[model samples]
Target: MATTPDDSSGQSTIDESASQVEILDADALADEPLPEDEAEPVDAVRPPGPSARQPAPLLPAMRPSSRPARSGDLLGYYLAEVRRYPLLDPEEEKELAIQYQDTGDPEAAQRLVTSNLRLVVKLAYQYHRQWANVLDLIQEGNVGLVEALSRYDPYRGIRFSSYAQYWIRAMILRFLMDNYRMVRLGSTRHGRKLFFQLQKERDHLIKQGIHPSTLALSKALNVPEQEVINVDQHLSAPAMSLDAPTSASGEGRPLNEVVGNDKAVNPEQDVARNELGEVFRAQLKTFETTLRDERERTIWHERLTASEPVSLTSLGKRYGVSKERIRQVEARMKRRLRDHLTRELGDEIPIYLEAPSD
Candidate 1:
């Protein structure tokens, strides 16, 4: 049976299946990552090999260029560029996804991603008020798109765009939270909730001629009064240069020195950290024993765990493949490492909020 892109009525112009992935409304975003796991120490261990400099992130840069003066102009340029890729119908999407899954075909994956670039832009628009430059949000969203490609399961019967939207939104939200203030906000889920809502709720109260106090906002939002005060203080606090002196006195110490100058080290914490490092290294060695393929084993040793990782492009040449293919392989290995750790450690694995970079 030949499938039509149109709905059952055959009257709808939009492909309902593709349209399903297109809906990423404000209410659908999640407040935070999973609950804290016991593996907090495990999370601290950088899974990939140590390097002089952090291996470049799998994602694109937060700010690509300083050239774009106004966000609107840059957006207009992107809108035009994204429009060049036509939307993929359901059949086309399924075909591409299945092909990519079977062979790790970069072309298939690229099509799936390019077709949905506009959707990423649409999702990024929802956070326009959160950040001044929409381009930055879109940049993060692109990371999510590539990430989604790495994890997307075509046979699961989920629409690609629908699944990709979650990644898109998550990347954007994380970017917003990270850059929200000079001192990063608390990692608590409640803090994330307050970060998004506290200001809006306060604005509503002010508009209604009611002063938004810690108590009133707490009662209205049903969060703790202290959390409300803490969030409000952070929001209201002005950014200051740490290089500046702590006080107006001419011979005063720098704020950084005065604020966090404690040189005391906790012996227990140091011991526990050392123990966790040993366990992490042990697990990596154990995983290495499980790799059967020559390429997989080489990548594991030379790139993933090497003190200085080989570049993906260089690895690609060694394997007679593209850097993108090398990346896909590296990502798969990391996923396996994560899975191996999860099975061995269960929920005890520490949860670090940031994406892992080797």
Candidate 2:
């Protein structure tokens, strides 16, 4: 015979299944209000949602691999692989340093160097202005990077990047000192500093007419007054004249030609050889009418005529007047005639003044 269900056991089994069914029904009712037993205690703020369902516990993050991986698919493989391994973990880097130091592991050293290529590229940019060529500076900086790697010490407690800075700077500075023509320009520290400062100062001076005084330069460069003066003198020195004319435009007149020479000529020979006799004779006939006195009139006509002129002293002797007085009379008559002729003849006639003879 089938055993009759034990009454208590059957009831307890039914109660457990019913409880599970209730839980399932409640889970299915997504929008149902929370049970009173599981609900948050009444307060000013209400719970955000159903209280029986606690949030799932968060899992800790997995550590990312330092090495980048090559991705593959069922069909094909891509050419490029992102190498996350190039990024150094501090601990892994420390180990690499020890291995390189103790065992001379070239691989470890290579890892360190490849990891820092970006850094070398960065530092090279600082000095590229003076060198102008990026490739040249990069090559120069690679030497610096190698020197930095050779000298990097893990024991000093300072970071490798910090230690490498000094070596990098030393290498770059050596390259600059050797290759830069500006270094030859200024050997002394003061001179070197002033070389750049003086350029700016000179530009400012030229544009605005401001003089670069010794005090101003000394203050600007933090150099001595004397050094400023010496540098300025060198800077301001006039360029040499290459001994060539600035242009081929005209004959270069000498200083002697710019100045003049004065000398006398023989008055008698000059008068006899003169060519303006016809114009003078016409003007003289017109001139005689101005002289009121007969003696003055005769003296004027004979003495003041251009050809065969007599001296003022000879004319004065004939007129019984001092030479100065006769000369004055002759000047008055010539002025009157010049005015008369200029008004009548429209100034086209050339009137030459007779020389006052002794």
Candidate 3:
């Protein structure tokens, strides 16, 4: 059985470090190869271990006695081959950890990693339902495992498996979140939190006979109710491509091909419209300067003319009142702006306001 550091101090340190894991998605991790460089030859990796001084006398058994007919069977080959390496005992594992940490011995580090290949496979299997292919998770897990080896402190007296598992899970969860759909879902911090905790919390509540409503999940995951709803909706949605057929039948046109085009534009009219838009915005700003009350000014700027208007409920909560009160304030501000714009610019100029609907 492979051994690891499991002292109380080490466990506490691991727990604290686990919480401090940076909120980096797979893309950020991918940008810089923080993990081992794949191009480095196994022997070329340094600082060279005792093998540098020892004479070379080894035979490789990686090639099969008889070549199999199957080709491009990478996963199958890995599954069959990984079983050949045996797990290390406690004494041997600690010695290797010390060797690698002290001298940066690639060979010692490789042994420590290979000894725990089974651990990665087992953990990756647990997340099989999350990802279509378990091998991807395994690959990510191995990266984490290698990273853990670089940081592994043999003096901590904690089991390396227990410590390394945290890194492995973090990597796998990030991969799952980043690749949740064709478009990345967990790009933001709160998004990642929801991706990691939403379903887990929902399942817990469900097991306890709770309905797991958006509000309930919001409190359970400590995320905004709207964020929870958005993430939940995204999680349940399937990815669709613009190039995909519009109908189930193969005869259907691609969605992008079937989309309607806008009417032909007149260059003079387009230029006039663009100029009018600038005038309208300038007039709105001039009108905003006339507002004396802070609440009215904020309502006009944030909810009336803004591109993405703040919701009445959100404003009400921020201002400590009912959404109805927010609507009333917004309605009054909009009415003033509209009347001012109509009198100043006449009906010829287009004035647009993004308002909440009833």
Q: Which lDDT tens digits does candidate 2 get at residues 1-358?
A: 0112233111111122222322122112222342334211111111222231121111000112223323312001100111111446667777877787677676777666544444444454455444443333444444555555565566544445444444444455445544543343345677555533565555445457767677866776677888777666543211111111111232222111111111122332232112122222333455556678886666554554323457788778876778898778877776776676554323211233433344
**Model 3: residue 202 alpha-carbon error in angstroms:** 4.5
Error of 1 at 28 (Å): 22
Worst 10 residues of 3 by lDDT: 53-62
| Residue 36 lDDT (model 3) | 35
TM-score of each predicted structure versus truth? 0.41, 0.32, 0.43
**Candidate that scores best on lDDT:** 1
Tens-place lDDT per residue, model 3, 1-358, is 0111243111111123222323112222223323333322122122232232221111011222134423544344444334545567889999988998888877887677766666666566555545545556666676556656655578756556655655565566656666764225434557755654566567669869999999999888777788887777655311111232333243333322222111222332332223223334445556868896887877765655443557888888888999999898876776777788665543322233336443
Q: How many residue pairs clash in each candidate?
A: 5, 4, 8
Candidate 1 residue 338 Cα shift, in angstroms, is: 20
Candidate 1 residue lDDT tens string, 217-279: 998888889888876764431111123332233233332222121122233223222323333
Candidate number of the best TM-score: 3
- Local lDDT at 173 for model 2: 45
Full-model lDDT, candidate 1? 0.53
lDDT of 3 at 296: 80
How many Å off is the CA of 154 in candidate 1? 1.3
Clashing pairs in 3: 4-158, 4-159, 4-160, 5-157, 5-158, 5-159, 6-158, 6-159
